[model samples]
Each structure stands twice: as C-alpha cells, then as structure tokens.
Target: MMVRTVLLAGCVSFFWTGPVQAGMPSVSLDLTDIAQLRLQSISFFLMVLLLSALILKLCWNLLAKDFPKLPRISYKGALGVSVLWGLMFLFVLTMISGARELLTPGAWEKSGRTYRLVEDKQPDDASLAAETTLDERRRKLGELRSALFMHVATHQGKFPGKADETTFAKEFWLQPGPLQARYGYVAGDKQADPSEPLAFEQAIYGDDQQLILFTDGAIKVLPTTKAQDVLNGK
Candidate 1:
C-alpha cells in the first residue's frame, strides 16, 4: 500500500507541477515576498478549486489502504480545505513571479525582492512635437503629389495648372493643405518630358535641406541653389 501510494504521488508530481519563471536578471524574485499580481481571477479561482477538490478526493480513495488508521474525512470538508490550499498557492506563485516594472511608493517594499529606479526621466516635448509636425507636413506634401499624378494620368498628360485647395478626401483624391504654398507651380498646357521636371519643393526646413518632388515620381532633398538652378533650366 505504501509503495503504491509513493508511486502514485511521484507520477502526479512529475506530470502536473511544472517550473515557474519570473523576470530578467535585472529583476530579482524571492519566495516570501508578497506577489504584486493577481494570479487567478474569480472565475479561474472557482475552476481551480473544483479541479483541486476532485484530485484530492481521488487521491484520498487511492491511498485509503496505506493510512488505514487515519480518521475518515468527508469529501466535502476535504474539498473545502483543498480549495483553501489552492488559494494560498495562488498567492505564493505571484511572489515567485516578480515584475520588471516601474516601482511606486505605495507598492514598494524595502525587501531584497523590490527594485526601484534611481532617477526619473521625462520626455522631450519640444523635439517630439517638432517631429510630429514634420511628419504631418511630409504626409500632406505626399498627398498633394499623388493627386497631381492622378490629374496628369487622366488629363491628357498635363499636370494640374493649379492645386485645388478645396480638393479633399471625397473618394480617391487626397486633400491639399497650406504645405502647397511652398511649391512654386509652373503654368503650361503640357510638358512633353516631365521626367526631370521639378513640380514644387519645401524651403521651410532650410536652404540646403529643401524637400523637392519631381515629375518622374521621385522625391529628393536638395540644396536651394541646385533646386533653383533646375527650375532656371540649368
């Protein structure tokens, strides 16, 4: 009976209980520290309780011969105790699984398991805002270029004489915005070869950092002098 009990326990332990891991090397974990996470919610806790109870009852029946002197335990009471044990285990598992997160005063403990940042770093709003604005400007310019390309495709091979400010996202057309002001439009019925032609460019960035869009569907950043030379038939 004892041999069978030992064999049964060994099999269950080998198959069921698995290893649990925590965080990176930077985050330390210990057994006794309070877990900062909720391992099981209400529904999951109920499920685990019922499953633990079933296993406990099965084990009790199987090991009855080994412990013939043991007092009889009602299945209901044994199941209730098993559920309580599961709740305690759920709480401990959280402690073993430490988090690599920002530490706050309310949750921070002076124990070896708890870690905190020495300094607080804030974002650079000025640079972030500048980057966001630049991205928006770039998108607007691309949209305008696309609309002009579509116009030329169906308008007998001629680029739009003027950018329509009121043109917007009605369906296939992209909207034009104030960014169009940077572009110096050329007035002509049609240019036989617009392959190397300069449609418009942005001079807002810098004299040497101008974003120029070409007629050949190529966009490049060039110096103001070179771009002006291209415009002047250089």
Candidate 2:
C-alpha cells in the first residue's frame, strides 16, 4: 500500500512539473548557479527520504500485525507520508536534472536558452577567462547598440564620435561600463549608407568573427582580415 501510494504521488508531481515547464521554459544555469541549486536539491531529497522512511517504519510498528498495539494506527497517515515524500522526490530529481543540463555544454541547448550565450566553438586557446570575457563582450556589444541609437536620435542622426565602451556606458547611464569595448568606434555621421562603414570592432581580442556593429544598427560577425578591410575603407 505504501509503495502504491508513493507511485501515485510521484505521477502527480511529474504531471505538475510537465505542464509548468511547458508553459514556462527552462533557463540554463551557470556553474556557480548550479552549485547552489544542487545543494538545495540534495537537502530536499534527504529531508523527504528520511521522513518517508521514518513514517513507513512507524506505520509498520503500529499497524502491521494481526493484533496491533497502537489503537491510533491509521493507514491514512502512512498514505500521506508516502505521497508527500514521493512528490518531494520528484521535485528534487527534476531540479538536479535541470542543474546538470545547465552545467553541461550541448546539454543546455536541450534545456532551453542559456543564461550566458555560449560560443559556437571553443578557440584553441580557450580557457575559463577567455570564455567569460567573450560572453561579457558579446552581451555588452548588444547593449551598446541601444545607447548608440539614442545618441543618433538626439544628435541629428549621428552616433557619438570616436566613443569607447565608457562613452556608451555614460550615454546609457551605466556609469562605468561593464568591461572595456573590444572594438573601436566610428561616428554614424561619417557614413551616408548605413552598411558602408564599420561602427565598432573587436580589435583587442583579435578573434575571428569580430563583432561589427553598423551605423544602421545591424551587426555582422566577420573574420579579422575582412573586418580590417572594411575598417580601412576597402
């Protein structure tokens, strides 16, 4: 009866999570984030496991005999314990699985959108620092576009002149920028055609697919050599 009750409660939890997850997609967790998540999951698991075991033992001692000693022995109480623990077990298992997916590359793709945008490929010299820098740079570059557009709107359709990350940061009220801009900047006023000139670069890192933000707010990823040509007015 205990096993049957536990299985029924487990099914209910699976149903609950499935619909909730369907309505709200999973967001990938970072390594640091998942570390905390796993700790919580383990604590939850242990609490439920111990509670269920204790309840089952108590129920056996009180009610599992031809002539039970305890008059207060109730099947309902054992059923409640089984159900509660089963639900808890399902929840903890789901959390652990989600955390594992977030920490594992290629695994996050299945889970949903990653918290940190991951590079398509790891560079030959890629390390934790490189990946962290690259992710920060990518996010900053996207954010910088908004500030640049605001500048253009206010300044006769011209972007800020020769600006760096700090300049855009100031423009956007971010105070000090999250990180220095990897790319150089050219004013939007200089170019008539939106696609003609390089607005900014990833010159510092010198990576292929250097992020090139355009005067028209369109961004392109280009190789370093081709990006140099564009910057040189080739």
Clashes of each: 0, 1
Give the poorly placed runs of model 2, Cα more than 4 Å off: 1-129, 133-136, 164-182, 204-207
Model 1 C-alpha lDDT versus the unseen true structure: 0.59
Write the residue-wise lDDT of candidate 2 on 1-234 in tens digits. 999999999998877844343466679756687888888989997787667666786767666565555555455666676778688998998898778767884534432433444457744533332444555555666677777676667767655556652344454322113343344666434543646554555454534656667766677777888978887778
lDDT of model 1, residue 176: 32
**TM-score of every model?**
0.34, 0.36
| Alpha-carbon runs more than 4 Å astray in model 1 | 1-138, 164-182, 192-194
Worst 10 residues of 2 by lDDT: 172-181
Which residue pairs come into collision in candidate 1? none
Please give the distance, in angstroms, between residue 77's alpha carbon in candidate 1 and its true position after superposition: 75
Candidate lDDT (C-alpha), each: 0.59, 0.62
Q: Score candidate 2 by lDDT.
A: 0.62
